[model samples]
Target: MVEEVERRKKEILKAIIHEHIFTAEPVGSRTLAKSYELGVSSATIRNEMSDLEELGYLEQPYTSAGRIPSDKAYRFYVDTLINDRENLNLELIKLLNNFNYERQGIQQIMSNMAKMLSSVTRYTSVVSEPQMKKSRIKQIQLIPVEGKRILIVLITNTGIVHNKIVKLKQDLNPRQLGYLNEYLFNNLKDKRIKGINNLVLQELEKRLIKRLDLSQEIIELVYKGLEMVSKEDDFKIYLGGTSYILEQPEFNDLDNLKKVLNILDHEEMLKDLLVTIPNKELEVMIGHENKIEEMKKCSLVFASYTVGDMASGKIGVIGPTRMEYSRVIASVNTVAELMGKIISELSG
Candidate 1:
């Protein structure tokens, strides 16, 4: 069983982690005594460090050298010692870019958000596309341009619009187009994409097949296009500042650097780094706690954002284990709240 750390030991542990995070080097007792106002001699601080090491909070990397904080030490520091992070808010807001959300699509907004996070935090940023589970069909329009060509616009209640152009073998007359529009609106309007199944598919097919005056081939093509736009993207992960993490001193090793880069290069694996829980606000995963083998040497800070009650998305920063917890945490919180508010307003 692990024993509780005393007040002085906790203070010493916090100091070591702070020094190591700043300099990326092993923290020795003499340096702590000289720099920090610990009110103790070097010998006393050294003794406390020894006890802290024995208790598994600190580890020595070399023989007769300074010690570094272990994963346990980092976890303790993040959970207990973090202070007011308001000083960095102004800088973060500027980097986040106060723009017109109503004019931008979700894709552009998310891409900009990823870049913003990386620029501010100097770490790799990953932002997931907003989930659209409850987004229902708002309206559908078919506009004719020229010979045998038409434009289809599918708008979702969540403010997502999809446009497609198709060439039909036969031109659709205005009367036929009006009838088809009414039929589509009566049957599919306000229907959730998730609820579209085989039963619904059979009914749509059966009714369309019975319409002998309409072109079956054109309806088939239209169905294909509509289905494509209605579904959600398969794990779309927007990545930014991927090379920034490589610049960290901890990723100096070539082998370790390659492993981390591989994870970032692939979306299937990167998607696992950001998972959104509906109501939970924020999460910080340190070292092995992240549960991904290639990412065990890194840390991930995640914040969940939602589009009103329809769907939720995620944004995060990936950096070395010795991360600036206070700044990163505050930044993620700020961005998540700002993003959720803008998206909700647009959707509403």
Candidate 2:
């Protein structure tokens, strides 16, 4: 009997979610019976709705009204109703084709795509640009310029090239800089060195200790090159339509608004939370499903975007659980797919 009631409870919850998604209104028992074609009486649905309310799936905003889904209920609905990538391939192709399909830089692609997503979904959209932290180094060049300065250029296999200038103890000639460049490439080529900073300098020092002439200057140049790389390796998050939330009644509370803004202000946390490397099509972390207090009141929809079939980028949407899952999830999936495509074309 408990299992039977539980199944019917899910059925009622599904009906409520569908109705609420379309109407954006709390679902009363009578409305559910008439609109959902549930083949159940309003009295029966009301009783089951009451039971579901007890189970923490539904809530009544006021004494005299119908039930709205709690965050818990929204989680269940997203987990069940949104697992499959429905009509995603066809819609994704359509949306991608609508774009010029040219090789726009990843940043431009994300910004425009985020705008499009925000326009369609009317929710806050965040697109993380393709980060090359995990990519391996392809080559390093030390070019001798004038006035005791040498330019260190590091190129990654993924077509990202970064350069920095370091003042040398002695202004080396082009021949010496060329030798150093070749040596660094011989040692560091194909190495994943985005995280390698001063520690890498120390290691290179130990390796080149025998060649006292090359050790100090090479390490200094490498240090400066790494500083440039670190600066470039930082994530870029483009957030569109934060103001859209102000229009929603739920964010009317000043305190809640502050919390949301704080979360948005810490763009690094957003990158860290959403840009993890996971083989997931869509990631939905519900209220309290997140690790932070600010996010406890909301939900995040994230998906990883790959660059050139190798490197991973991230794109997502953030909004209340009442967010239209089918539509927003579709938009997120489509944007993530395009982010990957754009990065692949640009990087290739």
Candidate 3:
């Protein structure tokens, strides 16, 4: 009997959530009891809904006749109700296939994916180039600019390049820098440069020190500069539909709008938000489930796009907590996967 009551309550809750998502309005117990055919009276559904409200699953605003799903309820609905393994709709699959993305670069793919998501979900979308740490070195070009500075150009598999100057204590002539460039190209080109250490630097140091008067300090400086270059490569976040949030009822408060924009301005924080879960698969953060205080009023769904073994990136959508989880999750996952495939094809 307890199990039966629990199952019926779940059904009623799901119906309410579904209806609310569709209408963006509060759901009345009588409506669910009558239209959803819960096989129960309005009185009984009202009792159950009152209990759900008490349990933090539903909220009744201003003594209203209808109820809406609370953050906790949305969390429960998303976690237990969603079946991610289910194949996407055939129309959705066909739409994804029609993108003509085979030869497109990762940037265009991400931009297209964002636009697609916004069009379908009526929400803002942001796509980040795969995070830099997960990417491998595709090529390194050391260009001699002056006697003391060399422009170090690092290319990753994600079609992005990072350039920095390595300041040397000693002036290195073009010929010497040319030999150094050759050494870098021969040994380090196409190598994953993230795990470089003292021993690796020592080996290169021994070889180069004998050939030139370059100090260990200068060699280590170049190596450290490259490390900073790699971390900076993690993301170039492009945001769209930011104005859409302002149009939502939840963000009508000017202060909340300012807070949300302030949070988005911190790129590293956004990276942390996207990458903290550490899953290559799609993940959803709804309402209060987000650790950031400003984000508590919204929901975020994103996925990490891998670029070979060298790097991974993120693509995600941000909207009010009332977002359609199934649709957003599916679309975001599709975009991330397509972006990854495009990146791989580009580097290959």
Q: Specify the highest-lDDT model's number.
A: 1
Off by over 4 Å in 2: 1-5, 87-93, 101-103, 139-153, 160-176, 194-203, 206-221, 224-233, 275-279, 308-311
- lDDT string, candidate 3, 248-281, tens digits: 7778778878778876778777766665554657
Which of candidates 2 and 3 reaches a greater lDDT? 3
How are the candidates ranked when ordered by TM-score, highest leading?
Answer: 3, 2, 1
For model 2, where is the 10-residue window of minimal lDDT?
Answer: 83-92
TM-score of each: 0.80, 0.81, 0.89
Q: Could you tell me the TM-score of candidate 1? A: 0.80
Model 3 clashes, total count:
9
List runs of model 3 lying over 4 Å from the truth: 85-95, 146-148, 309-311
Q: Which should have the higher TM-score, number 1 or number 2?
A: 2
Which candidate's TM-score is highest? Answer: 3
Per-residue C-alpha lDDT of model 1 across residues 1-348, encoded as one tens digit per residue: 134337778788889998998899999988999999988889988999999899899999888659998888888888988862644666677766666566788778888888888888889988886654456777888788797888878776656666778788898888878877778877888888678665886688679768737767888777766666665553367888998977899899988899899989888667655542223677888888877788888888888877765446788889998888888888888887777887778766
TM-score of 3: 0.89
